[model samples]
Target chain A: MTRSVFFVSDSTAMTSKGLGRSLLSQFNVTLSEHLRPYINTEERVDILLNDIHKTHIEDGDAPIVFASMMDEKLMNKLSQGFAGVIDIFRPFMPTLERLMDKKSSKEVGQAHKVGNQHLYQKRVAAIEYTLATDDGLKTTDYDQADIILLGVSRTGKTPTALYLALNFGLKVANYPFTSEDLPEFTLIKAHLENRHKLVGLIISPERLLSIRRERRALGSYADPKAIAAELAALNSLFARESIPFIDTTTRSVEEIAASIMAISPT
Target chain B: MTRSVFFVSDSTAMTSKGLGRSLLSQFNVTLSEHLRPYINTEERVDILLNDIHKTHIEDGDAPIVFASMMDEKLMNKLSQGFAGVIDIFRPFMPTLERLMDKKSSKEVGQAHKVGNQHLYQKRVAAIEYTLATDDGLKTTDYDQADIILLGVSRTGKTPTALYLALNFGLKVANYPFTSEDLPEFTLIKAHLENRHKLVGLIISPERLLSIRRERRALGSYADPKAIAAELAALNSLFARESIPFIDTTTRSVEEIAASIMAISPT
Candidate 1:
C-alpha cells in the first residue's frame, strides 16, 4: 500500500519545477495535481477535502499535504479534516513574524531602502553595458560582446554565457566551434574580429573520456586515447590562435562562470 | 565631487548584484574596484579606511561603506575605525545569532535534512528529463542553440527566453525578433520541427508607440497604426503556422516564460 501525498497550492506549487518539485522529492508518496494557481479559497478547500476523502476511502493511507503561501482560512479548515497534513509555511512563520515585528524599527526600513536601491542600480548598469557595440560599435548589437564563447562537444558554454549575461549582465554570444571550423581563430569574422573578446574552453582528456563513456558505454568516441588526442589538438589550436582558454575539468558551472566574469574586462 | 562608497564582502555580498547596484545609484557614489569573493578582515578594513580617507581628503564628502556579511571580528575592527559606516549585516545579526544559539537543537538538523532532500529530488527530476534528449540536450553547450538572438529593438525576447531557460532549464534558443530577424527567419529553415519550440513575442501597439517616442522622439515605426499593423501581420503568421506566441504587452518575463513553459509540451 503506497502512501499518497497531495501538494495543493497555486500554479507555482503544482509545476514540476521550483520549490514544489523540491519538496515532493522528499517523501515516498504520490503527488495529487488537483491544486492549481488563481484558485479561490473555497475551491482550494474543496480540492483538499476531496483529496483527503479519496485517500481515506480508497488507499486507506493518510496523505500528507504541503502548501505554499496558502490562505489562512482555507488552511484552518483543511487542518480540521486532514490531520495528517504538514504546513511547510509554519516553519517560515517565525521568520516572517519576526520581520513584521521589526517593520516598526527604523533600521529595518533603512536596510530595505538600501536593498531596493541596489536592485535598481544593478538593472541600470546592466542596461548600460547591454547597449554598447564592437568595431565602430556605433549601435547596440552583437559587436558589443565582452566575451564570445565558441566550442564543440559537451563543453559547458551556454550556462556560462547565461551566468555572464544574468550575473554580470554582460552581452554574451556563443557559436559552435565545430570540427569543420578546426582552427577557430580565422572564423572570428566581421563584427566579432578584434572588437569583442573571445574565450575558448577545453575539457580535460580523462573527463571527456568518462562523459562520453557514460553516453554510449564503451563506444569508440569514449576511448581515452582518442579523446586525449582531440583535446591536445584543440589546445594546440587555441595556443596558436592566441585565444585565452580555460580547462573546465572539475569546476562547477558557478565556479567556471565566476572565473570568466572575473577575467572579463569590465 | 562624487562620494566614493566601498562595498566589501564575500560572495553573498558581492553577488547581491541587483540590490547593491540600486542602493549605490541613490547615493550618487561610484563603487571602486573592491568587490570580490572571499574578502578577509584586514582587506575589509583596508578598503573601508582607504575609501573613507579618499572621500574626506580628495572628494570632501563622507564615504558610505555598505558592507554585507562581514566577519564579526572584521566588523568590530572597521566599526571602531569608521564610525560613519553602515553595517547592513547588523539587521540580520539578531536572527543569525539566535540561530547560532539554537545550533544544538534537533529541529535544525531535521530541517536541514528535509531541505537537502527537497533540493536533491528537484535536481534528480530535472536530470532525468535532461538525460533522455539526444541533440546534445543533456550537454551544456550554449552555441548549438536552434535560435541565436540579435536585436537592439527591445523586442523583449531575450528576457523572455532567459525566463524559460533559467526557470525550466529548457534549451530555448531566442534570437531577437528584430527588423534584421524579419529577413533572417524568412531565409533560414525552422530546424526545430518537433524537436524544439519557437516563440515570437509582439508588443502591443500603444507600448511600441511610447517606447519608440522615448528613444528616437519620432519615427514611422513608432506610429501607432503602423506598429499595430506590423504586430497584426506577425500575429497572423504565428497563428497560421500554429506556432505558440505571446503578446508581451502586460506581462513580466517570468509570466511569459511560465506560459511558454506550460505550452512547451516538454
Candidate 2:
C-alpha cells in the first residue's frame, strides 16, 4: 500500500522533507508526499487537517505528517489526528529553553528571509564569480578567487564550486585539464601565478571512464587506458607542484568541498 | 559581549546552522559560531561539553548550543551543560512515536548519504546538463531540458537554473536576452520549439542596473536607461507571448525555484 506523507512547516518545509525522506528511505515502501510550506495560521492548519482526514478516510490509512511548526497550539492540533506526527521543532525547543535559561521567540519562517542583505549580496556575487570563472573561462581575476579547483573533466569540480559559492559565499574558480596541457606538465601562466589557490581533483580511472562514457559513447576519451594515463599524468603534475588534491570517486560534493575548505587557506 | 554559538549534530549540521542562523539573526547581538558535525560518539560529546564549559568560563557567559542528535544519551549529556541547548530532533520523536505507534531506528546522518545510487546519479547528470546548456549554449538538445529560463542579464536566471538542478534533480537550461534578440520580439527558434518549458525571469530596472554595474562598472551595458528599456522590452515579449514570468527583484533563488515548480508542468 502506498503511504501518504505530508511535509508541514511554517517556513520552507525543506528540513521536514529532508528528514522525512531520510527516515522513509529506510523502509521499502512507496510514499506519496505533499509539501505544505508556510502553514502558519489556524486557517491553513484547518485546511491541512481536512485534507489529511479526507486522505485517511479514502485510503483507510492515516497519513504521516512531518512538521517543523514552532507554534505549540498548532502542533497540539496536528498530533491528535495523524497516523504519525513528527514535529521537528517543538521537541527540541524545551531543551533549548532550559539550556539557554530563556524562552524561544516562537517565531516562524525566519530561516530563509532576507535578513542580511550583505550576506545575500555576497552569495549572489560568489555565484556570478563562479559562473564567470567556470571551466577556465576567464582568469584575469584569478588573483581575487578565494579557492581555485583544478581537475580532469567530470571530476565534480563545477558542482563543488557552485556548492561552495552557494553555501559558504566563497569565490571559487575551476579549471579542467585537457589533452593539450598534458605530457609537458606545464601550467598556464594564470594558473602558475595563482598556484597557491589551487586544489586538484582526481577520480578513479574506472569511474572517470564510466562518467565520460555516459557523456560521449565509446570514444577514446572514454577509454580506460586513456583515462588511466590522464589521471597518472595529472597526479604527477599535482605531486610535482606540491598541490593538494582529493579523489572524487566515492565522496559527495559536500564531503569534497568540506575537505577542500579544511585544507585551503581561508 | 559576543555570544558563542555551537551548532552540534550527528549529521552535516546543515539544518542546525540554517535554523540557528535564522533564529540568531532575529537578535541583534554579536555572535560567533562553531559548527561541530558528525558528533556521534560519547567521546566526542565529552569533548564538545568540555569545550562549551571552557567557553562559558572564558566568556563568563554560557555558549548557546543548537543540536540535532538522535541519541537520547547524548541529548541528556548535552542538556546538563552551560547556556541553552536546542535539540532539533528529539522533541518531536515521541509525538511521532505515539501517533505512528512505532519506534524510531534512531539512526543518524541518513539525510545526505548516497543511499540511492539512481537518485544520486540523476542529480549529477542534471548538474552536467545545466552546465552544458548554460548561457544559451548548446541549444541543439533543448528538448531534453525540464525547464528553460529566459531573461535579460543579471535577472537571476543562471543561479535559479542551477538551484533547480541541484535541489530538484531538474535538467534546466537558461538563455539570456540580448538587444539583437530583442526589438523584433521574436522567439529564438530553439526557444520557440520548446516554448512550453520556458519560464521568464525579470528584475526591477534599478536592481538590474546595480547588478550589471557591479560586473562592468561604467559601460553602455550598465546604463540604467538601457537596463530599463531591456526590462520593458522583455516584459512586453513575455506578455505578447503569454509566457508566465516572475519578478526576481525581492525573491531569493529558493523562492523563485519554488514558484517555477508550482506553475511548470512536471
Q: Which candidate number would show the highest DockQ if scored against the true structure?
A: 2
List clashing residue pairs in candidate 2: A91-B91, A96-B85, A99-B83, A99-B84, A100-B84
Q: For each candidate, give the TM-score of chain B.
A: 0.50, 0.89
lDDT of 1 at A165: 60
All candidates: DockQ = 0.09, 0.32
Q: Which stretches of candidate 1 lie over 4 Å from their true place?
A: A1-144, A150-152, A166-169, A173-202, A212-222, A233-247, A250-254, B1-9, B12-15, B19-35, B38-155, B171-202, B209-223, B230-247, B250-266
lDDT of each: 0.48, 0.77
Superposition error at A252 for model 1 (Å): 4.2
Q: Across residues B1-266, which tens digit of lDDT does each residue of candidate 1 receive?
A: 24455554443233233233333433333444344433455764676576577666775555555554335677677767775445543443343234223222211012113234233333323323322222223223333443322222455554544534443445455443334334223313533333244556677777766666755666655667656556666666566666666666655444455555545545
Q: Give residue B112's error in model 2 in angstroms.
A: 2.2
Candidate 1, position B191, lDDT: 32
Deviation from native of the Cα of residue A212 in model 1, angstroms? 4.3
Count of backbone collisions within predicted model 2:
5
Binned by DockQ into CAPRI classes (incorrect, acceptable, medium, high), candidate 2 is acceptable
Per-residue lDDT over A84-122 for candidate 2, one digit per residue giving the tens place of the 0 to 100 score: 677666555555556555676767655555344466678
TM-score of chain A of 1: 0.51
